[model samples]
Target: MRIKYSIPIVFFVALVIIEKENNIISRVSDKLALKQTPQTPVQSSRSANTLPKRNVSVTSQGKLSSAFMLMKRRLEDYSDYQPAAAVTTRRKNILLLATTRTGSSFVGEFFNQQGDNMFYLFEPLWHVEKMLTLETGGTNATAAAKAYRDVLQKLFLCDFSLLESFIDPLPVDHVTASLFRRGSSSSLCGEAVCSPFVKGVFERYHCGNRRCGPLNLTMASETCLEKEHRAIKSVRVRQLEMLRPLAEDPRLDVKFIQLVRDPRAVLASRMVAFAAKYKNWKQWATDTDVPIDDDEVKKLKSNCNSIRMSAEMGLRRPEWLRGRYMLVRYEDVARFPMRKAAEMYKFTGIPFTPQVKAWILKSTQASKEAGGIYSTQKNSTEQVEKWRFKLPFKIAQVVQKVCGPTLKLFGYKFVTSEEMLTDKSISLIEDIL
Candidate 1:
C-alpha cells in the first residue's frame, strides 16, 4: 500500500510541473505578440494590412524586423531628396532669352558665378544658329524649328554627346575655353561636393592635356545630373512662341527670363557697330548680300519690328505664361543691380545667399569702371540714358517713330527732337516710362 501511494504522488508532481511550464510559455508568447504590434493606431485599412498580423510568432517577428531595418538603411542612403517647397523640388532649368546686345551675357555670367551646383552654358544655341546659317536656303522653317527644340531638350538634359557634332576647338584664351580648363574638379565638383559618378568621371578625365582639351562628354553629362541648377542663355530664340512647347512639357521645369533693352539704344548701338564693320553703305550691303537700297535705317527698322513682336507676345501674358515668364529690363538691372538680382533669384527659386550678393557688388563695380563691347562698367544711372546723347537728333527721330509704340509698351517715354538736340533731360524720360 505505501509503494502504491508513493507512485501516485510522483505522477501528480510531474503533471503539476508540466502545467506551470505550459503557462510560462503562453505568457512569453503574449508579451512577444504585444511587442510586434505597431505603436501607432492604424490610420487606414490599407495600412492595417501592412502591419504584422495578430498571430505573428517570435521567429517571424525577428525576420520582419531585419527586413524593416534593411529598408530603412537603404532609404537613408538614397540621394535626391529636396527639403524646399514642392515647386522647387524638381531640378531647376532656366532659359535666359534676349535679342543681341541686350546685356544677356552679363546676366548669364551672374548665373555662372553662382558657385558650383550650377552648370551654366553661355549661348549653347549659337551652334544651332551657325548650322541654320549654313542650311538657310534648303532648310524648312518648321523642320528647323523642331530641330532647334530637339537639341535644346538634349542639352538641358545634360547630354553633351550631341555637342561633339558641333563642338569646334575654341581659342585658348576664349572665355568658354578658360571655363573648360578649370576641369570637373573645380566647376563640376564644387569644392568636393559632388555625386560618386561625377567624382569618378572627374578623377578619370581631369589630367594635364585633357584639362583644357575638348570637354569630356561623359563627365559633363554625369555632372549635369548631379547639379542643382542648369542654366542656358540664348539670343537665337526671337519669338516667345517658339518656347511654348518647352514651357508646356510636363517632363521639364523651365523658367524664362525675357531681357529687354530700350529699342532706341539697341538701334543706336547696332548702327554704330554695323557702320564700323564696313567702309561704306554699299560695301556693307554687298558684304551682307543685301540690296544696295537696304540702308542702315531699314535694317534698324527690321530689328525693331522683330523685337517689338517678341515684346508684344510677352505683353499678352497668354494662359501658358502666367507664372513661367518674367520680364527683366536691361536698364533696371544696370541701375539697381542688387535689387533686381534679388528679384531674379526669387523668381528662379534660387537662394540669394551672401556669396551671390558679394558677386553682384563686385561684378557691378567692375562693370562700372571697365565697359566692354558687350557691357559697360560706367555708372549704372548714366548708362540708362547714354543712348539719348550718343544718337543724333535726326536718327533718334527715325527710331522713335519706328519703335515708339513698343517703347511706350515697355514704359519708355518718347523723346522729342528739341529735347534731344538741346541735350535736355526730359522729365518723362527720367522715369522708367
Candidate 2:
C-alpha cells in the first residue's frame, strides 16, 4: 500500500470511530437544530460540504501527526453529515371541493391571493372532464373519479405534463395555450409561468395585466414545484369520498375543504347564472308543477345526496382524513369572509398572509360586482341575501322538498311561502348544524 494514500484512509476510519466515541454526532445534531428556521428545513448537502480551513502548524518530524490532525478536523466537520433528505420540507396540498355556484371561486381567492408562496389552480380538472367526456361520453364524477384522482395526485406533486394531453389532444407535442381558467391562477400569470407581452408575438393570450404566448407547462410546473403549498379548486368532484386515495397517499399531505351552500340559494343563483341549463327550473319557478323525477330535478337531488354523504364522511373524521377535512358553508363564509378564510388557512396548515387578508377586505366590500357571475370580487354581505329574493317560493319549495336532508344537515331554515322567502328580516340559515 502507498503510505501517502493508505495513511489518509486509515486516518479517515480512525477519525470516524473517534467521532462516534466522543458523541460528536450529538453535537452536530444540536448545531443543525440551531440552524433551523421556521420556513426552511435543515441546511442542504452543500452546507455539509462547507469545511473550515485548518491551521497546519507542525514541524517536518511531525508531518504524519499534522496529516492525522488535518484528517481528524475534516472528519469532525462531517461528524453529523446529514443529507438534505434527512430533514425534508413537508408540503401542504389543498383541494377546495364544491359544486358549481357554491362561492368556490370567491373562496378560492383566499389561496390565490397568498402571493408567490401559493400555487393555485382554478378548475384545471375542467379540462380533464372535457377530455374524458369527449372520449367516454360520461359526465358523472363516478365514471371519472379514478382519472381525476390520478391527475390530481400528479398535479399536487407539481406535475402538469399529463394535463397537456387532456388540454389539447390534437397537438403532436401535447401542449395547449388553452389551460382552463389559466388567468385565475396568480402564480401562472406571474413572470415565472408567463413571459411579458411581446408586440407581434403573443398579442392574443392576455393574463390580466400581462400578455404572453401559449402558457408554457414546463414553466408552470417549475413554478408549482417552487411553491411550499399547492391548492386546486374544482366544482367537478361530486363527493369527498372519491378523494380518499389523495388523503391517504404517503407522498402527499392533503386537506379537503368542502364548501357547501344552501341548495335553495344555489338553485336561485344557478337559475340566473347558468340560465340555459336552469330553464326548466326557471319555468317551474312560475308556479308550474315540478317534475320530481325529471333529470334536472333528479340532478339537484343527486347533488344534494352527494354533498350530504361527503359531509357525513368528513364529520366522521375517518383515519384517512386524520383531521384534514374541513366542511365550510358558503353562507358562513359570505357572512364572515376574513374569519372563514383564516379558519380555512389554519385548517390547511398554512399562514393567513396579510396580503390575503387585505384582498378579502377589499374584494368582499366592492361597491359593484365585477366580472358578473364568474367574478371573485363582490359585495358578499349583500350578495348572501340576494338569492332569497331571486328564488321564487315555488322553486324554493321544490329545492326544500328535494334537498330537505341536506338543508337540515347544513343548518338552513326552511321557508313555507313566497312572503317568507322574500322577507328581508327572516334568517334562512341557523347556526351550523
Candidate 3:
C-alpha cells in the first residue's frame, strides 16, 4: 500500500496509460463487503502521478483538464456504494459536532476519505473563533454560536464569499494562501480547484499530499458544486441547539453526528494536546492532587454539563432532528472502527468507499502517534485505555465526582483506585441503551 509517489516516469505527449491502474481502486472497493473480510491493505497498480493524459471534451467552462477529469472518472469507483449511487450523489451536508480533544479528528476521516465525491473542511470555524469578538459573558457565546452557524451554513451550500470576511488579512479576488488547514480538504487540494493547472498533483499518492497554490475561493466553490457531499468537522460548536437553524434550512439537507469521549479521558487528552490552555490541569497531574473545588474543576464541571446536555438534546430527537441526529461515543469507535463507521455512514445515508475502509485499516493499527496530538493515525485499541494509566487516581476521582452523571449518561464506568484504573483486564465502557 505504501507505493513511493515519486516513481520515475516520463510525462511526454501526455500519453494516457491509466486504464489498468484505474481498475485497481474499483476492484479493491468491490472486495470490501459488510462482512468482516480479511483486513489486508490494497496496493495500487501504479503511482497516481503517472496517470495517462487524454483530451476532455469541454462542454462548459467548468470542465477541467484531462488529468483532472480522468481522475474524477477513477475516483468514481464507488464499489461499495454503487447501488446507492443516486442516493449518494445527492447534495448532502454533514456536521461532525463535538468538543475538543475528543478524537473528532480521527472520526472525521470516516467522511474525509470518501474520495472525490466528498468536499471536506476541517474546523472552518477556527477562523471565526479567532477574528470575531463578542461580549464577555453568555451574550458573547450566543453571538458566537449564531456567527458559527451562519458561516457553516454558507460553507455547506458551497458559498465561501462570506467566509472571506472572517479570514484575517483577507483573500484578494477570492484567492488566498491563508485558508486555515486548507491541506486538510481533498476537494480544495484537487487539481481542478487547487490551481488553474494542477496536473502535477497527479504525481502524488493523493490530493491531500499534493502541494497546491493559493486557494481560490472561486475555484473552491465551483469544485464544491461538483462534489456530491460536503462535510465539516468542528469542535468549535458545543451545543446541538446552536445548529438547529442549519438543520432546518430548506436549502440544505444536513445531518448531525455528535462525537463524545469519556470526560476524564477528555481532560487527560486536553492536558497534552492543548498544553497552553490546560496548564493548571498539567500541574494538578504532576501533583496527583487536584483541587476538586477549584475554578478549574468548576470549568470542567461546566464542560461536562454542556456536553451531557447536548447529547441529551440529540438523543431526545426533537422534531427538528427527526432522522437527522446521531450521537457516537469515541470509545466505541476506537474499539470497533468498522462497525461504528458502517453505522455512521448508514446514518448519513452515504456509501462507505474503499478509500475510507483502507484508511481505517492502515491508520487504526499505527505503531506510534504519527502527527502528535492532532493525528488521526493511532493504535486505536491502545488509545481507548491509555488515559486510565495517565490520569492520576485522585484526579480521576475528582472528574468522576464532578462529571459523574455525564459519564454515566455516556456509558463510561468509574474506577475505585489506581489499581482498578490501570487494570487492562476490566472494561470501563458500559453499553448504553
Candidate 4:
C-alpha cells in the first residue's frame, strides 16, 4: 500500500513566494515540495531601477542601519585566517571586494573580458533584502560564530535545483541555452547564462570537494553538475566563519580582487544613477533627519560609506579571511589598467598571457590608459578638476567637512573652497575628482 500526500495549493504557493522573496530557495529537490506552486520574482523590472529607499524615519533607519552594521561587524570576526597546512609552493587566489559604485563593475567586466577562465556577473550578489538586512540581532564572537556557522551550513548545504525550477516561469530560456549549451560533462560553461547562484555553487564545490585538487578544474563530470544540485552543497559557503574553517581545504582554490575609486567621482556618478531615491548633497547636508528625494545623494553616501567600511573592515580581514584576498585601487586600475590587471593576474595566480594583456589594454584604453588619468571619462583628461564646479560650494564643503578625515586617511587631501579652483590645487583636485 502507498501513502497519499497532498499539500494545499495556496499554502504551497505562499511558501514559494516567501522563499523567493527571501532568496532562500535552492536545490532542485525543493521543487518536489513546491510543485504546482505559483511564484514571481521578488524584484520586478521597475524594482531594479529603484534603490532600496532609505526610510525617512531616522529612528527606524538608524536602528536598521545599526543592525546591519553590527551583522557586518560580526561577520568580520572570521577575517584573520590562515590556511591549514604550510606550503613550500606559492600560489595566488583572487577575490575582488568593493562597495557598490567603487568601479567594481568595471573591474569585473575587465576581468571577465580579459582574464583567462575568469567569469563576471554584474552585481552577482545583488540581494537587496539581504544587503538591507546586513544588520541583524546576534551576540558576541562565540554566539556570532555559532550563528554564522548555522547560516553557512544552511547556505552551503542547500539544494539549488528547486530554486531554478521556481524560475522556470521567467523569460530566461535564451539565457539558459547560452549558459548550458550541448556539452559533454567535462567542459566549463559560459558566464552569460549562468546565474551568480550557479557560479557560486560551482566555486564552493571546487573549493571544498576533496576529489578535486588545487588549480585543477578540468574534471569532465564535475562540469556537468546541475545548478540546484551544486547549490545544495555550496549555498552557505559565503559566511566568513564557515569559510574560515575551510580555509585549509585543499579542494578549494580561491582569491579575492578588490576594486576602489575616488569617492568624489563615485558620488557624482551616483547622483545621476540614484537620483530617484535620495536627496541632493545640499539637501542632505541641511537635514540628516529626513530621506532625500534624490537617488544621487543616497547612493553616494551608501557607496562611500560601504567602500570605506570594506577597506577598513573587509580588506583588513587577512587574519580570519585567509590569504586569498587582494585589494586593487580603482585609481591605480584606471590609471594603468594593464599594469594593474597584470598585477591582479599575478595575485590571482592566473598567468597573464600576452593575449590577455592586450585584451585588457584594448578594453581599458577609454577607461584608464587614455591621456588624462583624472578625467571624468578616461579618454578626456580635462574633466578631472570639474567636480568642484560640478558640486555647489556649500555642498562640496560639507562633503569635504564630513568625509575629509576619512578621505585623508585613505590618502585624499581635502582642498579648501578657495584653493579648489586655483592653479595650485587644480592638478591635485583634478587627479582626485
State TM-scores per candidate.
Answer: 0.64, 0.77, 0.75, 0.49
The clash count of every prediction, one per candidate, is: 4, 0, 4, 48
- Model 1's TM-score against the true structure: 0.64
Q: For candidate 4, write residues 1-433 as lDDT tens digits.
A: 1223344666789998998865554334233322322212212222223223222111221122322232233323322343343332343323345554555544654444443233322221222223223545322334343443433222222222322222222214222222111121112334322223442223322322123221211222223232211111111122232345534546335554445555665565555556664344535545553243345444444345434443443433445444565445565566666766665655554555676566555555564555332222343233334454555445555455334423542444455555563443334321221
Off-target runs (Cα >4 Å) in candidate 3 are 1-89, 133-139, 196-208
lDDT value, residue 433 of candidate 1: 18
Residue pairs of candidate 3 with colliding backbone atoms? 16-52, 17-52, 49-202, 49-203
Better of 1 and 4 by lDDT: 1
Comparing 2 with 4 on TM-score, the higher-scoring candidate is: 2
lDDT assessment of candidate 1: 0.58
Considering summed lDDT, which 10 consecutive residues are worst modelled in model 1? Answer: 53-62
In terms of TM-score, which candidate is stronger, 1 or 3? 3
Tens digits of per-residue lDDT, candidate 1, 164-228, equal 45444432222123222233233443433232333223232332322233244566677778888
Better of 3 and 4 by TM-score: 3
Candidate 2 colliding pairs: none
Best by TM-score: 2
* Stretches of model 2 off by over 4 angstroms after superposition: 1-89, 169-175, 196-205
Q: Deviation in angstroms for 82 in model 2?
A: 28
